[model samples]
Target: MSQFSFLQSEFAPVYEHALKAESAALSDPRAACFYARLALETAVKWMYERDRALKSPYDTALSALIHEPSFRNVVGNALVTKARIIKDHGNRAVHDTRPVAQQAAVTALRELFHFSYWLVRTYAKGAKPEAGLQFSADALPKTAQVEATTLARLQALAKSFEEKTKAHEQAEAARLQTEQARAQLEAEIKLLQDEIAAVKKANQAAPDTHNYNEEQTRDAFIDLLLHEAGWPLDQARDREYPVRGMPNNAGEGFVDYVLWGDDGKPLALVEAKRTKRDARVGQQQAKLYADCLEKEFGRRPVIFYSNGYEHWIWDDAGYPPRGVQGFLKKDELMLLHQRRTGRKSLSATDVDSTIVERFYQTRAIRRIGEAFENDNQRKALLVMATGSGKTRTVIALIDQLMRANWVKRALFLADRVALVNQAAGAFKTHLPHVAPVNLITDRQAEGRVYVSTYPTMVGLIDDVQNGVRRFGPGHFDLIVIDEAHRSVYRKYRAIFEYFDSFLVGLTATPKDEVDRDTYSLFDLERGVPTDSYELDEAVTDGFLVPPKAVSVPLKFQREGIKYDDLSDDEKEAWDALEWSDDGQIPDRVDASAVNKWLFNADTVDKVL
Candidate 1:
């Protein structure tokens, strides 16, 4: 049964001290009769609510208990026996006109002490909520105030939780209502946009320099949208697109604009929102219409809707909705236009920040190339934020290496063991190789320009002890490490230094005081010929990926885990760790450690 844990913070001390006091002062000739009477009173309370009708009142306490229903609450036969004995003791001392012996009284007090002890033990063992929590049963006047405080606190917390839940439900309802309204407005906006577009297209197809109006502007925009979207605007005007449906495939659904791209044979279904707020907006409706038109034309139409005013684009219909994009006028487009959505030309500063600027103004390509100038020490470490394009960084580096041939062998190492294998596998897929690439695992330990676990080579020292081990030092030109703050990161440092290889470590987390050894790789102050290098140049050059730093705070129910200051047992384990003849721990020590023989009787099972 599930147990509700009561804190030792409140009731335990009172229980302990009260039991001690009772143990001390409660022993006297008269006390035996008092206890007996108390026991009889309890047994009688059981009689009033007869869940199981008793066969006879005179029956032994065992008979009454065994026949009782709530075995969980009352301890059946055993408790009944205790009650009977106490009643007998009371009769012998109090009512029989006999002087109670001191020993008899002391024995009775001792029994009371044991009963309290039993209650404590049962509580400590934990019990079900259905059984109810027992606290302050023997409460003194002094302790009642504190118990009341604890109860009050619990009540407040429950009330707070209920209030928060109710507030959240109300907020969610409001949000849902808001979303429905926005969708309705967006659809109305789309309809106005579509009508305007059809008008412009008619004028364009008509080949007349007609008087321009809102209708003409709309038609022009639709025609231009179709052309750019890769749909043949001329063909679309004549209803040339094909249509199909899923459940009912009788050409029920038509496609909009379907176009061929250099790669994706890319198809887009568009919904246009002409304005942010509009009545009866079915902008998506027109986009959907175009999508259907494309399907009818035997191609998936890249759908688009534009009001020549408000521009909202969706790639597909399935959404919250999804593929939602708002119109943002670029510097080229904003040279003259002025509105909340359209602004003046992008300033020189903004241009410098753009990705295109890195190629020209900042000489980003040149900066990357210069970092690789040194044959050995030219290894680079770039710190980019979370959203920063690390993939693009790797791609650019690969591109440089492939073109220049300054380096022969390249190995990319992700900080995670899982990522190491993943990256290597992904690399194999991305590149064309005449010879199969090697990544060491349990099955195979050797390969050209291998990617593998740091321990893969060291793990087999047992078999190697009797013979010569094959994998000594990898013959790679460059080794890059990702997520370098991990526990295994120190091992990589050892590899680059002792094994005489150029190293580059990459991480989303910057080096901090907590990880000094990790920071040693990218020593900022001295900037010596150490195995590490940090780049501020990439950011200056606009070549570095701009990252977003998002800090998500977590609140644990209790404080987070805090290990105690190192214990003697922990110190002993540290001292015991040693290399064997095989360069790994001896098998005996391994087995012993696995069993947790480091501590006590059950140590062996834990050591592993």
Candidate 2:
């Protein structure tokens, strides 16, 4: 008997996928994982279609659908986490080339079983599945001499199942053609909705009995992140790698994960901890593992410690430990290791004057370089007035950083699409050698420099492609915020927090003029910016023309029009005009109400 046999009666459409997932668990781990995710997706979509209480999300992607507020509210946090695991694993099974482990497939099946149980208990009108039922791997059918299928074949199989499911649903709907049958179905759906509501209320009051297994979740999350970073964990030496020279009696330890380079040297090592524990708790342990690897291989590997929620990277040979959003890719880690010995001093690098000729612009670049190179600060704020060549200045800064090997990829964010397009043009014009892509026009475009509006970038932050995020936390080495102000702080601050990159905020508004604490966003003190070129300075330097103010006065606007002061012709015209329904002309009109309530073309001509 299949572990998901309970779902066969009430959710036949979902049961098909669940049963296939169980059948392929041992024979084809990848297919099993893929089917588990398919089952969850089908079940969630089924609920959203039938449940009137659940609001449909604009995005139908599995990640977006499950993370939608209404879905999260119904399933709660624990179930949401389980759904995420299944979705992520299934995505990797289909999109990634690494072979899926049997253990991972088992994990996916267990999570799907619990998730299915919750769905059936809440929504099924027939016999509800028992909550005490457990998913037994031994009960899954063992197949001998199963045929190996390609990923493309698996996708085709899933597509076929979707077609069949659709046809079955249409046929079922055809049977309810009679008005009486349709009415009975509607009544049944209404009753089911009411029952679901009551169940939700009761579940809210009851204590949660689900075993979260946070440690397992943490390891799975870390695995997903590493895979996204291009680490193929197919080799036996990739995980739980044994090492010697520990201080304990056994004089040995097993590293959580080891990332290897083509030259047979360890590029980096990761130490994973439980989700609730601080990642720093493994810092010393990670350092010790690095020491052992260095003693064995003659080269120290970059040490990274993570608890799934937070990650930290420490290149003990070069820089202090710093927080990162995810693991660095193999090429990125290799380049980082190379930079330790080959990096040039940024202070010694010259600013490309051809790109930014202004003295203040060059000075601003120098101050920013000093902050990063000497002060060890990761954020810098540049306050310059509009039309002061902020775009050109940043292009030059990026040029210098790239030339010095400080930045490999950079992202520039603007509040408006027009600004994104304008900045992209500026980068292309000045730094023609480097490729620049405007995310506003084409999100899939690849380039060394990415330009995007804040809102567009926010949506793309969590967007996963081919089981990996297109813009991982460590994707960009630097991020430039154009027109950085209170507006960015209010609606799109997540963009800055999500990426593990050096931040350089460019703002036209002065500190005192902005209502929110803009300085705090850049980690700078109030009234102090990393560099400033005010409007007065720009005008004094002849970069901008000074403004001239003039005041205009009109007769009726300056003084209220008094009936006593009006000429006989004007008074006759006023009397001819209707001021109110009561047909009463006022003795005088206020200056503020002259054009608002009463308009005279002759008075407007005088102002013009």
Q: Which stretches of candidate 1 lie over 4 Å from their true place?
A: 1-369, 372-379, 395-399, 434-448, 460-469, 510-516, 522-608
Model 2: pairs clashing at backbone N, Cα or C within 3 Å = none
Error of 2 at 350 (Å): 1.3
Question: All candidates' TM-scores?
Answer: 0.26, 0.72
Provide the lowest-lDDT 10-residue window in model 2. 203-212
TM-score of 1: 0.26
Model 1 RMSD in Å is: 35.4
State the RMSD for candidate 2. Answer: 9.6
lDDT of 2 by residue, 438-522 (tens): 8888988888899998868867876665556778777888999999868667556657877878899998886557444678877
After TM-score superposition, what is the CA distance of residue 59 in candidate 2 from its true location, in Å? 5.6
* Cα lDDT, model 1, residue 96: 32
TM-score for candidate 2, please give it: 0.72
- Candidate 1 lDDT, 1-608, residue by residue in tens: 10112312222443333333233223334433444344334334323323222333322232243233343244433333334333434434433333445444443433333333333332333321222232221321222121211223433543574487579768866765877776886676567555544543443352322121333233334433342222443445223235444235464644333333333333344333333334126555655565554454544433435444334443342211211112211221121121222322211112213222233323333434444442223344544433344433443445344344333355555544777666665555544341224455533543334555554433321111111122222234456665656465544344453232335555555323225555456443322222221234345555464456998743321233122433678656644767555556332223334334345756655764
Error at 44, model 1, angstroms: 73
